[model samples]
Target: MKNHNVFIALLHYPAMAKDGKIIITSFTTMDLHDIARPARAYEINTFYIVQPVDAQRYIIQKQIDYWLSEEGRKTNPTRHEVVSMVKLLYTYDEVIEDIQKNRGTKPVVVGTDARPYPKTVSYQFLREEIEKRERDFLIVFGTGYGIPPDLMATFDYILEPIYGAGDWNHLSVRNAAAIILDRLLSRNRC
Candidate 1:
């Protein structure tokens, strides 16, 4: 999805920003409920990179329930918006192919903000450069357990890790995307 449209969706909530680029943000496992709305808003254009599991049906059902609940309704007009926003579900090979397709042509920024590791530095640098140039960006998230090492290696940058204030173990993937989107939007003046 285009970054600007994602930014506008996020702005629907008073807490999120109203302008600029949008990147992915993570939510702690426990706070998935809190982050669901912002995540749905950003998911309009953001790619959700999840692990391949046998329980895909169950997980998708749970996600549907989460999106249709009161919290999701408060943030989005209807569940279909969230359902339609999900664009791709890929294995590692597909992700590699997707990256290859965009390399050296359009600016593609990948955000991996969930984990903090030096390995993510290179991608992070590349992402920063893409943003500095005001180009198109793409973000990837990993689910199931965590992002595979190989996929993580493909990110343009790992977000600067932040410690959550609450009891949550870590930010949920949804909230993490919101944070990334928030930062991206903060960068644009238009």
Candidate 2:
């Protein structure tokens, strides 16, 4: 069976700016390609790109259309496969609704961040929870500074931030998604 239980969303709206204001962040075209590759590798069947602007959504949809087209597939079949998993939505609520419809149950919503939240859960705990395969999970990842504080509070579980050897902590959303997926779903994890 397809592993449609675990989903990841890349949110462009309601993200925090450096000035600490909620804003709709601009989409990075390559983020779709980079993040979708890992989502496919991890057997995650649905990848959500949440953007509220109509024009931005149109541009993204256009790119998706081309990738799903036969000509684009001829150019790169692997990309076509990866891009096929993307589901465009306007709001975070819509993402939840879609997952619920697919799984027949409300997913245990999880949020990702570079900072710790009161409800933050360890990767080990989440990995084991996902392994149970009894409940669906939707991991929400933000595009700007991070998901706003008010929005982050709504998630059921906030994953502990990924930390490297050094003090620096910022990671591109695409890289973060791959590492988080490997940690949660990889069979050969050490």
Candidate 3:
């Protein structure tokens, strides 16, 4: 299994549209729930939902609070265990800072895309690197159209796109993030 120091971020702000503008997308409650459960199940350290909008962030937090409440916990005990791992942060800087403080050093920022990118690395190599435990990693996933080009440049390495059987190459950010993490972390399954 990959080290638990690795984190995942679901980016909502500083993302892109089809046009050349940076936009803040709204949160999908289901995606937040779906992603977080799998993350905790897969033993990921933390799941950060990076949103700049206060209203959107409030809604997300409320949902999290519900899951953490006594009634919600009684309803689904395992889910409560996982949703507890979700952290709502406003900026990339907060994620970076938190990782640095927790890991006691800077992390290797990795970005994911639906298309090929420069400095793309293979999953096997990334998995191997994770086993070395030399550094922590934060893998960022974009929701809307995709991650912005400038944002892509910030990453130390971009993971190659997740390919399907055909040329069609779109997936819910939740599914993509879960699949990517599973591939990188699953030991016996692989």
Name the runs in model 3 displaced over 4 angstroms.
none
Q: On a 0 to 1 TM-score scale, where does candidate 3 land against the true structure?
A: 0.96
- Candidate 2, residues 1-190, lDDT tens digits: the string is 2466799999999899999999998889999999999999989869999999999999999999999999989999999999999999999999999988877889999999999999999999999898788899999999889999999988999999999998788999999999999899888778
Q: By the lDDT metric, which is better: model 1 or model 3? A: 3
lDDT of 1 by residue, 1-190 (tens): 3343221111111111123222222322333333444545444343333334435435554665666677877776555455444333324444445444644343343545445766454434543554464554555544334444454565555655545676444655556666665555444434
Cα displacement (angstroms), candidate 2, residue 70, comes to 1.0
Show the lowest summed lDDT stretch of 10 residues, model 1. 7-16
- lDDT per residue for candidate 3 within 38-141, as digits (tens), equals 79877888999999999998999898998899988999998888899999999988999999888789889999998998889999988888878788989999
Give the residue spans of candidate 2 off by over 4 A. none
Best by lDDT: 2
Two-way lDDT contest, 1 vs 2, winner: 2
Predicted structure 2: clash tally = 0
Distance (Å) between predicted and true CA of 23, model 2? 0.2
Name the lDDT value of residue 128 in candidate 3: 84
